[model samples]
Target: MKKIILTIIYILTLSGCGLEQGSYLVGWWNGDIPTKLSDKEEKIWDICREKTKYLPKNTEEEKEKADMELNNCLHEKGFWD
Candidate 1:
């Protein structure tokens, strides 16, 4: 039931497993949990967005590098790491 599902989410959230799990719980719960970004995360978000914008269009090499950079950024930020 709903209570059981919520209890499982609570346990996983506390265990600090990974962001995907945490994101789903918060997102699925419609922001039941706080999703505030820290100052550092805000800065990284800006950088990543800017970098994504400047990636060369119609260039395979540039696209690959951009993809790698984005992945690296996310990993560094501990999202998909």
Candidate 2:
């Protein structure tokens, strides 16, 4: 059935599920990836804030970058790992 085929494809895709940086320690490299995160994902959020602290003031681009930065900063120095 079409449904069965779609399900198989979905499973295959998720089988390789991974965040941007590929791993947590490597998180800082991408600035928009979260790898090896734990239950305390909040900790990584804080670290992202610190890493992007020096970025420019309020702006769409800055906000977008911050969001992406958070994706990768979660496991750097916070309790997320």
Candidate 3:
């Protein structure tokens, strides 16, 4: 019975799984400074990169968005330029 209960808990946990949408964008926003990213942000970036591999190639607009995000991240990191 204990084993069954443990299995049920595990299954429940797994069922809550969901990917971070905009994670890559967030990562791109959070500058590339080694100390800038929290552990969670880094993980989100990795997941975004992996997931975006299946997305259609980025358009110019997408590229612009990425640049904007990167700039935001840099600004947050105290970069003025």
Per-residue lDDT tens digits for candidate 1, residues 6-67, read: 99999978876555655867476676666678777777777776867677757888888888
Q: Give the winner by TM-score: 1 or 3.
A: 1
The residue-level lDDT of candidate 2 at 53 comes to 79
User: Against the true structure, candidate 3 has what lDDT?
Assistant: 0.60
Worst 10 residues of 3 by lDDT: 48-57
What's the C-alpha lDDT at position 52 in model 2? 80
Give the lowest summed-lDDT range of ten residues in model 1.
17-26
What's model 3's TM-score? 0.29
Clashing pairs in 2: 33-71, 33-72, 44-74
Give the alpha carbon lDDT tens digit for every residue of 36-77 in model 3.
667666665555555444544379887766666665655554
Using TM-score, give the best candidate's number. Answer: 1
Q: Listing every candidate in turn, what is its Cα RMSD in Å to the true structure after a full C-alpha superposition?
A: 10.8, 10.4, 12.5
- Candidate 2 vs. true structure, TM-score: 0.32
Say which prediction, candidate 1 or candidate 2, comes out ahead on lDDT. 1
**Rank order (by TM-score, best first):** 1, 2, 3
What does candidate 2's lDDT look like per residue over 1-81, in tens digits?
999999999997886576444566355655755456554665565566778878775999887887667665654455433
Residue 25 C-alpha lDDT in model 1: 71
Find the 10 residues in a row with the least total lDDT in model 2: 72-81
Cα-lDDT of candidate 2: 0.66
